[model samples]
Target chain A: MRKILLSIAVFGLMSVSAAAQADPGDFIEPIMPPQSINLGMVDLGKKLYFDPRLSKSGFISCNSCHNLSMGGTDNLPTSIGDKWNQGPINAPTVLNSSLNLAQFWDGRAADLKAQAGGPIANPGEMGFTHTLAIGVLESIPAYVREFKQVFGKDKIDIDQVTLAIAEFEKTLVTPNSRFDEYLLGKKDALSADEMAGYQLFEESGCVACHNGAAIGGNSFQKMGVVEPYKTKSSADGRVAVTGKDADRFNFKVPTLRNVEMTYPYFHDGAANTLPEAVDTMARVQLGKKFTREENTKIVAFLKTLTGDQPNFTLPILPPSSDTTPRPTPFSK
Target chain B: MRKILLSIAVFGLMSVSAAAQADPGDFIEPIMPPQSINLGMVDLGKKLYFDPRLSKSGFISCNSCHNLSMGGTDNLPTSIGDKWNQGPINAPTVLNSSLNLAQFWDGRAADLKAQAGGPIANPGEMGFTHTLAIGVLESIPAYVREFKQVFGKDKIDIDQVTLAIAEFEKTLVTPNSRFDEYLLGKKDALSADEMAGYQLFEESGCVACHNGAAIGGNSFQKMGVVEPYKTKSSADGRVAVTGKDADRFNFKVPTLRNVEMTYPYFHDGAANTLPEAVDTMARVQLGKKFTREENTKIVAFLKTLTGDQPNFTLPILPPSSDTTPRPTPFSK
Candidate 1:
C-alpha cells in the first residue's frame, strides 16, 4: 500500500511540472525581438519612412504620426494630417504592432504592408497619389538605384515601397518589459502592488479580450460592451469595413506593450489619463468598478509595460533633381 | 650676367609661390568641421531641434523648415509654418551657420542663439511663447533631469534652451567638399570646365561680396546691386533691423556651402533652378550676362560645394507625464 501511494505521488508531481510549462501566465506572452531581417530592405524602408517627400505637402512623413522618439505615437488626441486636416480617429502606436493580428483600429487592412499604402493616398493624410509618389522617387537617381538593388526590379512600384516599409515596421517590436520578465519566470520583476494588480486584472475577466503576446491585439472587441460610450467622434469603427450594424463600435484591441507612453487611450481618445481609461474599461467593458487604490495599482502594473524603444540613425535623404516635382503645399 | 639671371628667376619663383600661399583661390575658404563640442548639450539640443512639441501646433519643428535630411533647408519656395501659415522670407540653411557673421537674411538676430528664439514666438511660425515652451520641457521629468545634468540648473529658462540649440547648430557644418579638397591643395579635384567657371566667377567680381570660409556669409549685400529686383514678396530685409532707407532690400549674403541641396534661391525663393539663379544674380547683382554653356559650367562648379552632411542617430524623447501640459495643436 505504501509503495502504491509513492508511485501515485510521483506521477502527480510529474503532471504538475508538465502543466507549469504550458501555463506560464496562461494568457500573456513575452514579446521577443525579430531575429532575422533584410538590412538593405530595412535601410531603404527607414529612409522612405522618414522621407516627407512622400507627402504632397513635403512636410509630413510616417514619423509625423507614428513618431518613434515619443513611443511610436504622435501623443495627440487625433493626428493632424496634410494641410493641417484633423483625422477622425486616434493614431495607433506603431510599437510592437507586428504582433497585432490585423492593422489599424477597424482591422480594415490585412497587414502592415497593406496598411502602409492607406495613409499615403488618404485624402486627409499624406494627400498624395501612388503615381506622384513614384514619380518623385523615379526622379531621384539615388532612390532609383536603391529600389533596384533592394527589390531587384527595374520598375519602382507601390508594392515595393509598401514591402520595404512593412519590413522596417516588423523590426519595431519592443522587448524586455518588467511584465515580460515576470512572464518569463522572474518573480522578483514585479513589485507586491504590481503583482496584486495583475491578480485583480486576471480575476476580473479583463484577460478574456486582452490576451496573447501583445496582451490585446489578437481580438476585436466592442468599445462599449455594457454601456454606450459617449464621444464627439463620428467614427463607426468596423461598421465602415464590415457593412453591418452588429459590428458598430467594434475595434481591434490595441496592444498594451507601451501603454504608459501611448496616452489618450481608445478610439475617440476620450480618456486623457490611464486612471480614466482604466476606470472606463472596468465600468464599460467588464461592468466592474474597483476602488481608487486598486485602480492606482493597476496603473502601476501597466507602467511596467514600458520597454526599450527602437534605436536608429536618422537617414540622410538624397537631394531632389532639377526634374523632380516640387511640393505644392499652399496650392489647392 | 648668367648668375644674375639665375638669381632673378629664383626670386620670381619664390614670389609666385608666396603669392599662391596667400591666394588659394583668393576669395573662398574651405569650411572645416567643428572640433570639441559638448556632447551632452548637443544630444539635448538634437532632441529639442527635432521635438515638435516646441510648436503650438505640435506639427512644425526646427527640422520642418531647416530639414537636415534635405540639405538643412526645406527646399521650399518659402516655409509652411504653424496651421500651414505661409512664411514671407525663405528659410536659410542651418548648415555651417555658425560660420556666419550674423543670423537671418536681415541679420535681425546677432547669432544662432538669438535666432533660435525668434521662430518659436513668431505668430505665423512655431506660435508658442517662451514660458509655455519652458512649461512643456519642465513638465517632463526626463527633460528636467537632462537639463539639470547639462546646465546644472534647477530652474530651466529660454536662454539655456536657445544656447543648447545653438551649440547643436554649430556642429552642423559640412566639410570635405570636392571644392574644399581643391582648396586644400588637390589641384586635380576640379574638371576643366569647373576651373573655367571658377575663373569666370572671380573675373566677374562675384567674389567681392561672397568671400569667406562660408563663401558668402561674411557681409550684407543688396539683393539687386545693379538693378531693382522684381518680386511680389514684401520683406524689406535689413531695413527692419536698421530702420534706414539704405538698408532696404539689403540682405545677408547666404552661405553657398551645399548650395546644390538648398535650392529655390534668393529671399523670395523665386529662382527655381541653379541656372536661373545664376542668370538672375549675373544680371541684377553683377550687371553681366552669361551664355547657357557658361551657366551650365558654373552650376557644375557649384555642385562641387556639396559636402558630407551631419550624421547622427535619431534621439528617443521621453514620454510626457500625467501632469505634463498637453500640446494644443488645434485649439486657437
Candidate 2:
C-alpha cells in the first residue's frame, strides 16, 4: 500500500513535469521519422489484417472495430463482437500502438503481439480458443503449406500469427505528423495556433504522461489528479488487473498519434469530442483549467497527428463450398 | 436469352478451337492479350483486395489461401473457417483473377467486385451478412472518412467495397512470363524442357482457349470435353449458378497464370499434387496421355507462371484487449 502511494506520487510529478518544460510551449508535431522503414513483414501483416474468413464467425474481423475511417475505432463506447456482446472498454485506435511500451489502460499487455492474440479468443470478440483457431488454419491445406513457407513448418501457430502481426504494426509508425515535423525541427510545420497550442500543452503540463514517440503511453497516471474522478465506478481502470487500492483510477497513457480523430476519449469513453477531452484532461489531470484559447491551440496541434492511410487491395475470397445462396458471400 | 446462348456457344467454340491448336512442335503458353489496365482502379482495387478486415471473421483473411508465399494458394483441398469448419473446395490463387470474366467454378459472380462482395456473407466461409458487414465498416470512423474521401461522402457501401477491390484485382497481373518473353523474341527465355512442354501444350491444343493476356479466363467449357468428368456432383461446378441442363458439366476456364502454385486443381478439388492435377487434366480435358518426359516438361514450364509477392504491413490491435495468452506455434 505504501509503495502504491509512492507510485501515485511519482505519477503526479510526471504530469507536473510536462508543464514545467523550459519553453513552456513544447509541442510534438511528428515529422517523418528519421529511420528507414522495415517493410517486409509489415506488408504481409497488412494483407492478413484486412482479410477476414480468419475468424470462426466468418464475420468477426479486426476491421469490425478499429476501422481506419472512423479514427481507428468503430465509434462505440464499448466494442461489440461475435456474440454482439460488449467489450470491456472502448476499442482503441491502432494509429500509434507501437509507441506504447506496456499496452492497455491497465498496462496488461507487454506489446502488440500480446495484444493481437487477445481478442480472437475473448468471448465477446473473435471468440475462438487458440486450439480452435489453430484447428481452423490447420484444416486448410493451403494454410498448412503457406505457414511452412512464411514461418517454417509447425511455426504457423499462434505465436507466428501474433509475431507477424506485431512485426507488421511496427511499420505502421505515423512518422511525419505536422507536429512531428515541428518536433523534428521544421519551423513551418505548424500554423500559429497549433504552435500556440503546443506551448500551452507544455505550460499546462499535459506533456508529463503524454510525451515520447506517441506523446503519451510512456507512463500511467490517475484519471483525476485535481478532483477524485466521480465518473460512476468506471470500468475499474487498473484495479481489475492489479487489485490494489492505489492502482485504482490508473490507466495506460494512450499514444496521441492520431488523437484528433480518435475521439470519445477516456477509458469510459466519456468525451465524445476532442476539445471536450482536452478540456476534461486539463481540468482533471492538470489540477488547472485552461482558458478556451489554450484548449483551442492544443486541439489544433492535435489535428496534425493524423497520418496518411496507405492504399491496400482487398483479396477476393476463394470459392470451394458445395452450396451457397446468391447472397452467401463466403463461397467463391 | 438468345444472346446469352449465342455467347455461350461462341465461348464453347473458343474452348474447342484452343484445344485443336495442338502442334507437336509449338510451345503452348498464354498469349499476352492486350487491353488497357485502368491504373487508377488498379491502385484502388489493389488496396481493397489486400484488406482482410472486410470479412466478419478476421482470421479467415484472403491471404490465408490465395497467398503470394505459397504459390498463390494455401494448397488445401478445402479451406478452414471461423468456427473451424473445413470448407469443401481448395482456395484459388488471386495471382491472376482479373483475367477470369466469370468468377469461381460455378460462375456465381460476374465480375471481381461481385466476387469481392460474395465471401463476406458466406455462412460457411466469411459468414457475415450485408447489414453486419456494412455496419462493421460504418462503425469505424476512419474507414467512414476514407470511404468518403476515396469513393465519396456516405459512400461506404458494398458497391464501393466491391469496386475498390475489383480495381485492385485488375492490377494483380502476371507480367513478362518467360513464355511472354519467348513470344516477344526472347527465344532464350525457354529452357529446352520448357520449350518441349510449350510445344506439347500447343500440340496438345491447350492454347486455343487459354489464349489472351490472361489465358483461359475468356471462356467457359464443359469440364469433361473429351473424357467425361466423373465427378458430376462435384463442388457444384458452374451448374449451381446457371441451372441450365446444358450448363451442367460446364465451368469457366481458369487462368493458367501461376497455375503451378494454385494447386489441388479442378472444380471438385480432386487433385492433390500439381503433377497429378496436370496429368489428370490432360486425360480428362484433352483425351491424351502425357509421357513422363512430356509431363515433367509441362510441370517445369508451369512453375514459370509463379510471380513475386507484393510488400505490405499489418495493423496492431489496441492493447486494451490484453487477454492474449502467450501464443504457441500454430500447430496443424
Candidate 3:
C-alpha cells in the first residue's frame, strides 16, 4: 500500500513538471537559429543574390529591394525597380520570411523559392526573363563551374538559381530577440512596462492573429476586421490570387520579428511610425482604443522584437570573361 | 693587410647581394597590403559607403559605381547616375587608387577625401548638397554616435564624413599579384610568353609613363601622345582643371594593376577587350604596333596583374528613428 502511494505521488510530480515546461504562455514560440546549413549552396546563393547582372538593367539584384543591410528591406515606401519604375506595393522584409505560411502580400508564392523567381521576371521589378537570366549565368564561366559543383549538374537552369537563392535566404532568420529570451524562460528579459504592454497585447485580442514562432506569419488575416481600411493603393489583396470576393482585403500576416527595422507599415505603407501603426490596428482591426501611455508601452515592447542581424563577409564576384555578355544598363 | 682584404671581400659580396635584391626591375614597386587600419573608422566608413541616404534618390551608394564585387568598378561604359542620368566619363576603379598622384581623370580633386565629397553634391551624380548630406547624417542617432566615436566631435560635418570614407577606401589596395611574386624572386610565377611580353613592353617604351606600384597612375599624359585618337566623348579632360589649351586632351593615367578586370578601357570605355586596349595604347601612346601573337602574349601578362581582392564583412546599418528625416527618393 505504501509503494502504491509513492508511485502515485511521483507520477503527480512528473505531470506538474511537464505541464510547467510546456506552458510558457503557449501562444508564441521562440525563434531558434538554424542548426545546420549547406555551406557551398549558401555561398553560391549569396553571390547570386548580390549579382545585379540577373536583371535587365544590370542595376537591380535580389538585394536591391530586399536589402539585408537595412533589416532585409529597402526601407523605401515602395521599391524602385527597372528604369525607376514605382513598385505596386510596399516590399515585404525578407528577414524571417521563411517562417511565413506563404510569400508576398497576397500569399501568391507558396514558398521562398517560388517567390525568388517572381521579382526576377516581373516587368515591374528586375525586368528580365528566365531565359535571359539563365543565359547570363551560363555565359559566366565561374558561375557555371559553381553551379556544377553545388548542384552536380552540367547545365544551369532557373530552378537551380532560385533554389540556391532560397537556401541562402533560409539562413537569414533573426534569432535571439529579447522577446524570444523572455519566451525561453528568462524572467528579467523584459522591463515592467514592456511586460505590462505584453499583458495588454494578449488580453486585448492582438494574440488571436499574431500567435506563432514568427509572431504573425502563421496565418492569413483581414487587414480591417472591425472597420474598413481607406487607402489610395489599388492592390486587391488576396482576391487576385484566390479569384474570390470573400478573400478581398485578406493578406498574409507579416512576421513581427524585426518590425522596428521595417517601417511604413501595412500593404500600402500608410503608417510611418510604430505608434501610428498600433493606433490604426487597434481601431480598425479590433475596435479598441489605447491611451497615449498604453501606445508608448506597446511600442517599447515591439522594439524588443529586433534580433541579431545576419553578419556575413561581402562576396567578391569573379570578373566577367572575354566572351561574357556585357550589361546594357541604359539601352532599353 | 689580411684584415683589410677580408673586409673588402665581405663588402664586395654585400654590394652584389644588395644590387640583386634592389634591381628587380626598380621602375615598378610591388603593392603591399596596408599594415594598420583604424577599425572604428573603417566600420563607420563601410556603412556610409553602402548607405544610399546620402544621395537624393536614395537608390545610389558609392558601391553603385565603385562596386567592389566587380573589380571596384561598375563595369559599365559610363555610370548611370541620379534619375538614370548618364555620366560624362567612365567611372574609374577604386582599387589601388591611393597610389595615384591625384584622383579623377582631370585631377580636379587632389585626394580621395576631396573626391568623396564631389559625388554627393554633384547635380549629375548623387544630386545632394553637402548641407543636405550632413543633415541626413545628423538626423540619425546611430550615425551621430558613430561619427562622434570615430572623429571625437559633437557636431558631424561633411569633412568628417569624407575623411571616414577616404579612410575606408585607403584599405582597398589589391596586393600579391603574380607579377609581384615574380618581382619578389619567384621565377616560375610568370610563363615564358609572359616574360617575353614584359621584355617587349619595356623595349617599346610603354613603361615611360606606366612605371609605378599602380603601373600608370603616377603621372598625367596627353591621350594622343604620338597620334590623335578619335572619340565621341565631349570631355575636355585636364583642360577643365588647368584652364590651358595645351592640357585639352591631357588626363591622369589610370592604374593598370587590375586591367584584366577593369575592362572597357580608357576614359570613354571604348575598348571592350584587353587585346583591343593593348592595340590602341601601342598605336596611339607609343607609336608602335604589335603582331597578333605579341598582343596575345602581352594580354596574358596583363592578366597576371590581377591581385587578391579586398575581403570584408558587409556592414549592417542601424535603423532610422522616427525623428530622422525620411529620404525623398523620387521628390526631385
Best by lDDT: 1
Task: State every prediction's TM-score relative to the real structure.
Answer: 0.91, 0.65, 0.91
List, in the given order, the native-contact fraction of each candidate: 0.67, 0.00, 0.63
**Best-matching candidate per DockQ:** 1
Error of 1 at B254 (Å): 1.0
Tell me the whole-model lDDT of each prediction, alpha carbons only. 0.84, 0.61, 0.83
- Tens-place lDDT per residue, model 1, B1-332, is 22212322333332323433346555578888788799899989999998888989777789889988888988888998888889998999999999888999999899999999999989799999999999999998999999999999999999999999999998999989999999999999999999877767655656566657888886777888787899999999899999999889989988888988998899998987899999999998877899999998888888888898988888888777788788787889
lDDT-best of 1 and 3: 1
**For model 2, how does the per-residue alpha-carbon lDDT over A158-237 read when each residue is reduced to its tens digit?**
88767766776665556766766666677898899987887777666676667666777767677787767667435776
Residue B25 local lDDT, model 2: 17
DockQ each candidate and list the results: 0.57, 0.06, 0.52
- Is model 3 an incorrect, acceptable, medium or high docking prediction? medium
Model 3 residue pairs with clashes: none
Per-candidate iRMS values, in order, are 1.2, 11.6, 1.2
Higher-DockQ candidate of 2 and 3: 3
